[model samples]
Target chain A: MMAVVTVAIAVQGNLFAVVVLGSIYSFLMATALVALDAVDVAMTEASVGAGISTVLLLGALHLVRGEEQKPRGRPWLPLAASVVMAGVLVYGTFGLPGFSDAGAPIHQHVVPRYLNDAVRETGVPNVVTAVLASYRGYDTLGETTVVFTAGAGVIALLRRRRRDRRDGDVR
Target chain B: MRNYLVLRVVAKIMIPFMLLYALYVQFHGDYGPGGGFQAGVIIAAAIIFYAIVFGLATARRVVPDWLVETCLAAGVLIYAGVGLVGILLGGNFLDYFVLDRDPVAGQHRGIFWVEAGVCVTVAGVMLKIFYMFAGRRREDDDA
Candidate 1:
């Protein structure tokens, strides 16, 4: 079903349908995340990917025509490049431990400590939150800063538009 | 959109709940399958839904551009300030254990503020991006 949606999105000429299909694709991916027990990620995917992004994409679509752009050159080179990249990635995953292996290197490193001592140390029942907001505080701080930068960048780009439009660079 | 009576009425009903759920996800994150990022996106989506059902102008009035920008900067500050406070309390930057007499209590305090910062920043960015894109005149309109 995911594959079918991808193909539908790929072959669809109407940009509006493509955008809607993309939302469906995100919804499907969210479900897949849930199946993997990544409920946090699933929630983010549902809200960010399938929800707000669909609205954002529609806003972008409003700026352009309903149809896909005409191809100006052969697409085989990019297709071949993508295929090669996919193969190499698949090949690279071969050395990973079998699914849920108890002795996997990742399990050995920090998993036990976080599981055994997180509540005792941080008093937060949710290890995920404890890790995100405390143990990995710096990383979350950085992420927040990145989000701030992005918002600042967008404002710099768009907020002064009406005044700048008379300069003839944009319509 | 305004004339679509069913759409307007349903969205009017749903928007408040959507905002409420976003808040729920924000505070209930530590106990549930959610956090600031998800909650913030949910919040932005609720507003964007209003922008779609109503009009961009009306939506902007409800969430003015200035307020969104303030939230954007303030969230980063709140996160960083928590780290600085940790350092000032005789621990390394972002060391939550030093935040209170009880390290566990400190951890709770640190996580709460950090998540709040993240939620505010995420909500601001999402809304700002949506507004920027939606506010642009459609390319075909003038053509």
Candidate 2:
């Protein structure tokens, strides 16, 4: 299902179709993440990747031409580069510990504390929340800063109207 | 789209529910498979749906640009301020243990505020990006 959407998005000539297909692919990916038991990650993917991004893309489409232009040249070099990178990644993953392996390096480390003692220590029944907002909170703080930065960047770039565009020009 | 009766009606009906669900997700994140990031995007999605059905002007009126700008910075302030409180309480930065006399309760307090900050910022950014793109199209139309 996802592969079909991926190919359609790549081959579709109409920009709108591509955007819709991309959204479908994101939904499929979110479903797969749920199956993998990463429900939090899945929700993020479905909402951010599928829901909000589709709207953003549509807004973008309204600003640009509706049709995707044909490629001017073959993409052999990039294709080979991507294929090689994919193969390397796959080969690297083969050496990883088996799924749910207890003796895995990660499980042997702070995972134990987060799993066993997090609830008791944090008084939060949800270990994910305990870890994200309490134990490893600094990381989330940094991520929040990054999200704000993105908003700031967009506002700076787009706040000027046509008349103000001339006035705001530094050059 | 403006003249499509069914589309407008459905969007109007769904927008409120979407906002409600966003709040549910934001508040219930502590116990479930959700958090600020997911809930924030959901809130932005609700407003974007409204803008599509009604108009950008209406949506902007509902969520003014100044409000978006404030949210964009306020979330970080909240998260950082919470950390500052930890320092003021004589613990290291982001030290939840020092937040309250009871360390466990302090952890809960710290996490709640931190998550709230995340939700606010995430929603703010998502809306800001969407408004920037969509508002540009509106300006082009006006010109």
Candidate 3:
């Protein structure tokens, strides 16, 4: 299902349809995350990908043409590069441990400590919350700063465009 | 959209519920599969839905630009302020263990405020981006 949606989005000519298909793809990805038992990731994917991005893309679409233009030429070089990268990624994954392997390196390290002691240490029932907000506070803070920076960049660009329009130099 | 009474009415009814759910997700994150990021986006989505149904001007009137900007900064301040407090109490930065007399309670206190800060900032950022895009379109229409 997700593969079909991805193909549809890739091939779609209408910008609006692409956006809609992208949203659907995000939804499918979120569902896949849920099936993988990564509820936190699923939630983030559903909200950020399917919800907020769809709206943002639609808003952006309003400022641009509604249809995608045909490619000026066949891009064989980029296609070959993409295929090579995909092959490398697939080759890289071969070294990974089996899915849900109990003795995997990751499970052997901090997983036990977090599962056994996170509640007692952080006083939060949800280990994910404890890990995100307390154990790894610095990382979350950095993530927040990234979001802040992106917001500032968008505001600056939009404000500059408005100013340009006011000065009769509209693009 | 303005002429679509059904859309307006449904949005009116749904926005409050959406907001309430966002709050629930925000505060109940410690026990569930949600937290500040999801809650913040949900809150922003509610407001965006209202804007889509009732028009951006009306939505902006309800949630003024100044307020959104304030939220963007204030949330970061709150998070950093808590960390500063930890340092003042002779602990390392963002040390939740020193937030209260009891270490466990301190952890709870720190996590709650940090999550609150995250919620505020995330909601603010989402709304700010939405405003920038929507407002530009409005200005183009005006000119």
Candidate 4:
């Protein structure tokens, strides 16, 4: 099913179609995550990726006309670079621990403590929340700051008034 | 067009419930998939729906610009204050253990307040962004 969606999207390269397909892909991935019991991450992905990001992108499309433009030249360098990266990833993943292996080092180490005592420690029933806001809080704080900085940049850029061409008066 | 009055009436009836549910998600985030971010977006969506149907002027009247700015700053300040408490208690940065007599309880206490802060900031930011975008539409229409 996922491959069908992927192939359909890959075949249809129009901008609007791409956006809709991407949104579908995002929601599907979120559903897969939920099925794997990563509900919190799934919720975040569905909301942020499928909902907000897609809405924002569509709004941007409204601002900019959607006309298909072809690249001037073949992007051979980027394609070759990505192929090398994919080859490295495939080689590396072959050496990875089997899926859902309890004996994996990840399951044995930091994850065990979070799984065992997250609720008792953080007073939050959502283990993801406990880990996000309590155990790994500094990282979340940094991410929030980055978002704030981006907002500030957008506000500064857009808040300026430009003179009207017809009226010879400032907006 | 006249028949759409029913839609308006339904929206008026439903919006309050939506806002309340957002708050419920914000506070109940400790137990469920929801948290600050989800709550923030939910609140923003409610407000956005209002603006879409009732007009931007109505939303401005409801949320007001200054309150949004204040909420954003207040959330960050609250989050930072928790870390400051850790510093005052002679623990490393954001060490919730020293906030209370019992380390476990302190951690819980600290996490709650910080999460609350995140909720406030997120809600504020979401509203602010909506206003900006909605405001742009007005400008475009004027042009």
Chain B TM-scores of the candidates: 0.94, 0.94, 0.97, 0.89
Per-residue CA lDDT of candidate 2, range A16-134, in tens?
99998889899999999999999999999999899998988988899899999888899999999999999999999999999888899988889988989987898887787888898
DockQ of 1: 0.85
Q: Any idea what lDDT model 4 has?
A: 0.77
Question: Who wins the lDDT comparison?
Answer: 3
Per-residue lDDT of model 2, residues B1-143, tens digit only: 66889999999889889989988888888788898888889998898888888888889999998898899899999999999999999999999889889999998889889988998899899988988898788778875
DockQ-based CAPRI category assigned to the predicted complex of candidate 4: medium
Where model 1 places Cα greater than 4 Å from the true spot, the runs are A167-171, B138-143
Q: Write the per-residue lDDT of candidate 1 for residues A72-120, one digit (tens) a residue.
A: 9989999999999999999989989998799999999888999999999
Q: Candidate 3: where is the Cα deviation over 4 Å?
A: A169-171
Model 2 alpha-carbon drift over 4 Å, by segment: A160-171
User: In candidate 3, what are the lDDT values of residues B42-130, reduced to their tens digit?
Assistant: 99999989888888999999999999989888888888898999999989999999999999999999999999888888999999999
Every candidate's lDDT: 0.88, 0.88, 0.90, 0.77
Against the true two-chain complex, what DockQ does each candidate achieve? 0.85, 0.88, 0.85, 0.50
Q: What RMSD, rounded to one decimal, does every model reach?
A: 2.1, 2.1, 1.6, 3.1
Q: Which wins on TM-score, candidate 2 or candidate 4? A: 2
